[model samples]
Target chain A: MTQTKIDGRAKTREIKRKANLNLLERLYLPEIFKGLSITFRQIFKPKFTFEYPDVKWQPPASFRGRPVLVVDDETGVERCVACGLCARVCPALAIEVVADETELDKERYPKKFEINMLRCIYCGLCEEVCPEEAIVMSKEYELVFTSREEAIFGKDKLLTPASKLKDRLEFLRKMR
Target chain B: MESILIAILKAIIFILLFLTFSAVLTYVERRISAFIQDRLGPNRVGPFGLFQPIADVVKIIFKEEIIPANADRTLHTLAPIISLFVAYSVFAVLPIGEKLVIDGKEIKLVLADVNVGFLYILALSSLGVYGVTLSGWSSNNKYSLLGALRASAQMISYELSLGLSLVGVVLVSGSIQIDEIIRSQANVWNIFYQPVGFIIFLVSVFAETNRLPFDLPEAEPELVAGYHTEYSGMKFGAFYLAEYTNIITASLLVTAFFLGGWYFPFVDIYSGLNPNLSAILQVIVFFGKASLIIFLFMLVRWTLPRFRYDQLMRLGWQVLLPLALLNVLVTGLVKILL
Candidate 1:
């Protein structure tokens, strides 16, 4: 950015005074009529109304909705090693994880995981910070929670089968 | 007794029709404004949102009425009623059709048929300022007071041009009665002779009605709800109703003065039909002309930004008032020459 020698108020005032008009502009009616004519023409223009309830908008996988935990199709278990990276990176302090030992190749699994939907800004930082690509933004934008307890999403709500998360996974891979 | 019966019947029928038309206008305005902005307006209320106004009436009626503790109770209660009364009262003298024949008796379509109908309308419209001003003063709020002042000042400033513009029509027609004015234009509309005056009158009517581009009193950015800031529930509804009613009254006045009220072009060709049928057709024609003017009002509202306070003042005093006087002078000269 180029630094100015002085404050720009004087320059703006100069530009304002410089934009002079002739006799016709002084009349004002012609310009008013021109504006009216343009708006009159717009009466026949096509309207862009999305009847939202009847017609649901299916955004592409790259479109971030809400973050979800990815489950491995082969092993029928979560791909997450319960790493605290997401919890640490979440700006809103929305994510919580309790790690426990597991028998699987991934030695650690989250015994409990909760995200306070109220606190979550949906910034996708937690998803970005995940090392294993276990948490990714999903296509579940419509979220309505009546109570505080209902808003705190747990593992049962977060863990989606890998098959359902195919589009988002492919999208992330393409981006990388 | 017979005349009184006719009067009561006419009043009942016209009031219902007028209120219904105002409600429908709200729906039309929303739909048209939405189309202009490339968005769908309210369509979910009912079939094409036709029943939306009914729903609105219900909502407004049920809303709790709130009065500011410091507000003048008597003036606050009386203000909106005065506005509504004035708005509806102006329609009393406007001639909508020729004489109606029933049971071998003739009945004039207008309610009062005041000898100086045009002057009466102008007088009543000026009185409309009191309603707004009172609402503002009684509310005891700063914004409301400013709005009230703006409204009164703007109305007074534009009323001069408004009156001057109509003088062209009055001079050309050589009559003050609205019926006689329309009758005078059986051959040609006054708009042809007084084009400049017609334009001035149209602009002044926008200002008079507190419509957009001249809606300084209720400028949302500057004043929150303006004079009606403290008004709630049915009282607020009355103000809203008064506003829409004023719009219709202004359109009707424009029709009566410049557009030749019920006098359609080539009306002699259709003269062979039944007189009753012809009268109905004439009323329909008058309504058609008025609707076009009303649509223009809506189109303008969506098109133009609100004028700055000083700009509004300048346009009213400097531009329109002088132009109206010039038009009157030219019209007078032409009348004498012809």
Candidate 2:
């Protein structure tokens, strides 16, 4: 408390003194005219407003919007190895995975994969923990759901073609 | 009989014109303020948001009228009506143009050609205090009462300088009639002759209209919404309309008194032009000048920050009053000597 008090006093002493005004500046009318001219000029300056609904902003690859599962273009199948690491690492406990035996080369598949989007905090922890690089954040931020059940995104809604997620995957690789 | 009919017709037309002008003024003020602040204001309602005021009126009319349970109902209802009445009535004596000769009969371009137009305006504008005061008192809200008190005090203080400043014009013109005052400025504007008086009047007019730098009555930060805090729905709309109407009236008064109403400088009015054509041109010129003053009012509002209550009172009583008295004294002396 004593240290802070001394610092506060020093801070007060360090404050810059305001410049004294001359006779013309003290009159106020001239200064008002000066201010008015400034504002008048500002009226012709380019406005910074975005008509939101008419022109949607396209987020960059670095933007972490909503998480989705990536599907390989050649195989037409999700890249998930059903490792359950994402489910374990998710702080929100939003992800769920049920692994089962598969005939495919991966030898394991997710019988059930779902993400409760409402519970998602968009921390990208699931994406970071995934070994197979199955899940990544997409640029789909406008998430609206009428019911709680509808907010639980199943595999069908979570899957996105790899071509659409090229930017995020490339960005992740570069960052890594 | 026909003269009375014409007078009534003229009053109706002027009232409609004022109402429309006030609405458009709101849109213009919003758009200009937005531009100054680097934003696009209300552009969706119509072309360049021209119909925004119409939409606002519709929305306000349909809103739920909320009155405090402990409020005085009668006074609450009467308050806005009083405000609207005072605002509309003040425009009656303001002449827009010179006389027009139609069908061998000369018709004056004023709703009422009363000789004491100056005093009439002062008296009516003073009466506007009742609407604000009564509304504040009847609302039973602390903020509203404080706002009302500030309004009344401010008006009383500034009205002195306002009247005294205009006294210089009355001295020069030798009449309390507004049209006569305008006529006296045919040679040179009052702004040139009575520059000090014009400044005093201009400042007082800002205070009188409760505009910024003198808008303690409706200081949103201190008072919730000032005297109109408790008002809602079309009742609130009435106060809003009255406020803008006062702005228009003040602008017109400034233009007529200082800027030389209906007189285009360096353009001889009697220079071989048709009387009707000249009259129409004069009316257009008068409105154009008034519009410029109104634009100035809006610009000043956006430019200046509100003064502290103490600062406002000090400026009104100590500064403006003294200057106005000196202006009147000088004008009187000059008139007597010259």
Candidate 3:
């Protein structure tokens, strides 16, 4: 064994070929006592358990949850321009969009937009491909459906308020 | 006739107490193990999960009982019954405290107080092996058979040391009767006289109870629940109850023999108190000591990993047996010399 000084601290670099057991170690009882003491002390330490259902986990900004259409808070209209890039980029083919002329400055808007949550892989590819930053991943991960019809999320279900998705939008802006 | 009636009443009360204690022990074991691992155990069912065992019993009772095809039906049913029976019956001879006098009639804390109490305990505990063995054989499953084989072999190997270790206690106390042994320890506890024997006894008891570090019979990784693999519903619950009961019995025996049963050390505070009150205090003190040993049992279970079968065998026959015998020899020599 050799000792080397790194950052003013001695670090042993050598590895022993075999462990040399002393008389006390070979006897086994002393080692057993050491292990017992460790567990005994741990009984007083704080628990790491999260009582699920009663207490829920809040994921961080980087978390990629369900995809949603961002609804503008000021105008009360969806930010989607109906470019069909999200529909094309979806690997699961979960998204669908129908374009129509609108009175808004964007000119084109989705007449009918839907995302089949059942088929969604949650890959965030749609969120990445969208040029308008209209579709982004929201923090709402709890998706439950009773039937196939219910699983196909329509405009009402997919459109989330922009203010509610600020954390994910900010994270995406910084990362992108 | 009156003595027989008193014995029956005592037996009923003890049985109820043991059953309740074992149920509470399951909860305590889970809570303690969780604390050791930095997790909260089952605290959802009730406050601190005290009612978890009751929920478990209800679930087990409602579950569908499944006996494998081509398995011997009689022995399959009989195995768990035997296990539970032996676990409960061993306590019959265990002296908990000194005599209680009520209405000018004396009552012994122990149910039987048999003269051969020591031999009786040894005999009944060995009989507990039959339950494990029969369950494995009757299951007709390879894993169950392997578990039963391991259990019987381990129990038989450790029983030698377990019996021999107590011989030192018998020698120091000069009697095989358990109450006699307790009476002898009134001056000084047997652990001070036979520390080697105590260690050997403690180790052997761990093996005998099929606890962790020696639990080859139910080694989950290898044997897949061992002898109870094919058992389900209340039948499996029977085996579970029996295991916890064995732990309590082991703790009680350790307290009675080595830690000085029901006697407060170096003092006789009971001399000035009422006889009935003193007897109740003695019973409380005995159980308090036993619960400490029980805590040690739970601690050891969570501390050490299971020993390999070969290592377990070597530790039993090669190490503990020789040590127990030497302990007896030295204890006898000292008795004659002094």
For candidate 1, list the clashing residue pairs, or say none: none
Clashing pairs in 3: none
Residues B1-338, candidate 2: write the lDDT tens digits: 99999988888889999999999988989989899899999899978788999999999999999999999999999999999999999999999887889899999999889999999999999999999999999999999999999999999999999999999988888888989999988888989988999999999999999998888989999998999999999999999999999999998999999999889986667457888898899888988998998888878988999999899999989999999999999999999999
Q: Of the pair 1 and 3, which is ahead by TM-score?
A: 3
Sort order, DockQ high to low: 2, 3, 1
* Whole-model lDDT per candidate: 0.89, 0.92, 0.93
Each candidate's DockQ score against the native complex? 0.71, 0.85, 0.78
Please, what are the lDDT tens digits per residue for candidate 1 over residues A55-81? 889999888888899999988898889
Fraction of true A-B contacts recovered by candidate 2:
0.91
Q: Which candidate should be chosen as best, given lDDT against the real structure?
A: 3
- Per-residue lDDT tens digits for candidate 1, residues B1-338, read 99899998988777886798889888888888888888888898979988989998999999999888899999999999999999889999888888788989898888888999989999999999999999999999999999999999999999999999999999999999999999898889989988899999999999999999889889988999788888989999999999998998899889988887887776564367777888898888888889999999987898789998898898989999989999989888988898
TM-score quality measure for candidate 2? 0.95
True-structure RMSD for candidate 2: 2.5
Residue B338 error for model 1, in Å? 2.5
Clashes of each: 0, 0, 0
